[model samples]
Target chain A: MINIEDYAERQMRRRGMEITYARMLPVVVRRIADNNGQVLVNSMEFDAYNQYWYLVNAYELPVGTRITSDTHVTLLETHTNDTMEEFSGKIKIELPASFTGNVCQALFYQVLVK
Target chain B: MTGSTRVIHHPIQLIVRQPLTPVNIYTVLPGHIRRVVGVKVVHSVGVHLMSADTYLPAIGYLSLEFNNRSYHMGHVDVSFDNRAEASDAYLDTEIDIIPGSLLSGHYENKVFTGTDYQRADGTITDKWSNYIVTIYLKALSDD
Candidate 1:
């Protein structure tokens, strides 16, 4: 298994730093669409003091919903899709059209580098 | 290097039969791999079918969990367009696996409906096809 703490330690070590502590943070977003239209979830921003955030994984609940970053780029592109939903910078999710009211959810996993 | 470690490939095959539901599969790692270095997926060609003048790949999400860890690896597309047939399609990873660890793979197949193919006499309905997918794990091992 890939240890999140070990992965964060290596990420910091590559930049000539030592990780004092590491943690995994879960960001969950949910939205309900009133009609048969697409729901657009805005980009989520992460800000913390003395800690760096790295996107390690992401998931769409109910699955098969399109998740994107930077307006157009699909978060999981090509074969890398099987390994990790690795993305840098920003994150957003566009839920598919649904009849009646439906609830859509997106989950992102990030590692805190401190 | 210390124990005659070398690279190996472990392949797991899955058959998707239903739509709109998540199919779960798992495998126990051989008693050798110390670190999994890469991952690649091979999608069966039949997954991408031409229906009602539309060539659509069956959209699906793939999630991976190793050793029952709290953190998951994904919810990524495993459609036909994302197969690892090309040279650059291999996914590099740094997952360390204990010998005999359990690795699970989950897939959710989505339904895609296309327009009906209209002809002079009758119209043909579009249908989704069931297919197979193989996931390859490249790892460093000491046998």
Candidate 2:
């Protein structure tokens, strides 16, 4: 094998950057959806990772009616970068009686590493 | 008689890919020095903001994860262009991300706060409004 160092160097020069050492980590956010249980869940997990994950760029938005409840939305840390930093969180929303569809919703993160 | 063997060297090439998630309009801003907020993204490419109304600054950092396995990449500053009447064919614009802020294999989730983005009263707001940017990653991967 030629060696990864040389490869990394070539990668740098290609982009007009000085030669340096580091691997490219590609994390993909594939999907985002809303689920039941009043929890906005994401399937952003792997076997080597943790059941819990980090929630970034997260917030709450009422779909139709203004929600009012003490069950405020919370972001629980279930995992860290221990396994490349996974992200997972829940969204709790209290909707009005006129609201027809889901009371709360969320987005899913699907990361692929090559 | 033995046949002569040929030694071929495969030159390295940078392969680019779109982000796993789609950027929404909220993440895009319309200003000269804008800091992006509320978008869960790690990297962007070629200053392409995926819209005719937005532009990525000349310098910026997209922090999604850390490669050390013991830490994470923090936030950096950049201005996003969210001009409603911004011209087209701006595919050449590029953001300047600091080399020291990231490492190989560090995956970032949310892009928060721009250093220069402060309210008229001088307060920082880590939020973007309707910025649908296309983030591209450059890496060496199997074809």
Candidate 3:
């Protein structure tokens, strides 16, 4: 019976890869309010890398006004940028009416996987 | 890090005036800058309301455009607010640009006007002529 560490090392060696951790990338998404005091929904596409991306953490911006109660982050498996069958995802964040007429930034982290 | 490529930070300031009117500012990247890696809003004035009742900046929108593409489809104030102490508030991304490429910045003041601004001490005045916003671009140069 092979030990867990040895099995992991063997798998890494077989895959021609190094023992590393997930790569976390920071992304900022903005939700703008329209003239009618409605918060517009915003989305960002992650097509920069050919790896599976997962949301790690998210927080609303503007320092003191960290109101993220109404903010929703959705991860979609569909490819919005291209039809290529690569590992890509879309992140969409919706803000509530309270965020109307204000430009809010949400800082989020995405982890990349191979 | 290569010997041929050097890092540089280019700063640009925009003077915002006239409510509901967009203020457009542009800068040509120097010959050394090959790509813009990051952007940060360093400082800003005349954006926040002086009235004690209001604590947030005036309702405004800011956007960056380069190479015929906009970095953020909408406003970027949250990720690039001027209240940042250091370079902590920055958008880390790679934007390819050539020498002499035109990088544009657009801003629009949505709420406040010249006459209706109230100071913190409950004084109304039109002394605020313009809002000054400074942004720094971190780039890589292939010298």
Best lDDT among the predictions, by candidate number: 1
Q: Tell me the tens digit of each residue's lDDT in model 1 across A16-110.
A: 56666555666654454335645544233433434455444533233234444321134232223433433333444544333132443343344
DockQ, in order, for the candidates?
Answer: 0.05, 0.03, 0.02
Kindly list the per-residue Cα lDDT of model 3 for residues A80-114, writing each as its tens digit. Answer: 22111111223334433233334444432232324
- Ten contiguous residues minimizing lDDT sum, candidate 1 chain A: A70-79
* Candidate 2 lDDT tens digits, A9-107: 443354444522233333232223346534343222233232122222223322222211111112222221121223322222233222344323433
Which residue ranges in model 1 land beyond 4 Å of their true spot? A1-114, B49-58, B82-88, B111-126
Total colliding residue pairs, candidate 3: 0
lDDT of 2: 0.28
Ranking by DockQ: 1, 2, 3
* Residue pairs whose backbone atoms clash in candidate 1: none
TM-score of 1: 0.47
Number of the top DockQ candidate? 1
lDDT of 1: 0.54
Task: Compare candidates 2 and 3 on DockQ and give the better one.
Answer: 2
Cα lDDT of model 3 by residue, B1-143, tens digit: 36789888888887765543456556776777778888876336665443333334435556666643223233466222343343464688688775676675566555554446634333445744466767778989877
- Which candidate would rank higher by DockQ, 1 or 3? 1
Note the Cα lDDT for every prediction shown: 0.54, 0.28, 0.48
Off by over 4 Å in 2: A1-85, A88-100, A104-114, B1-61, B78-143
Q: If the candidates were sorted by their TM-score against the true structure, best first, what order would they fall in? A: 1, 3, 2
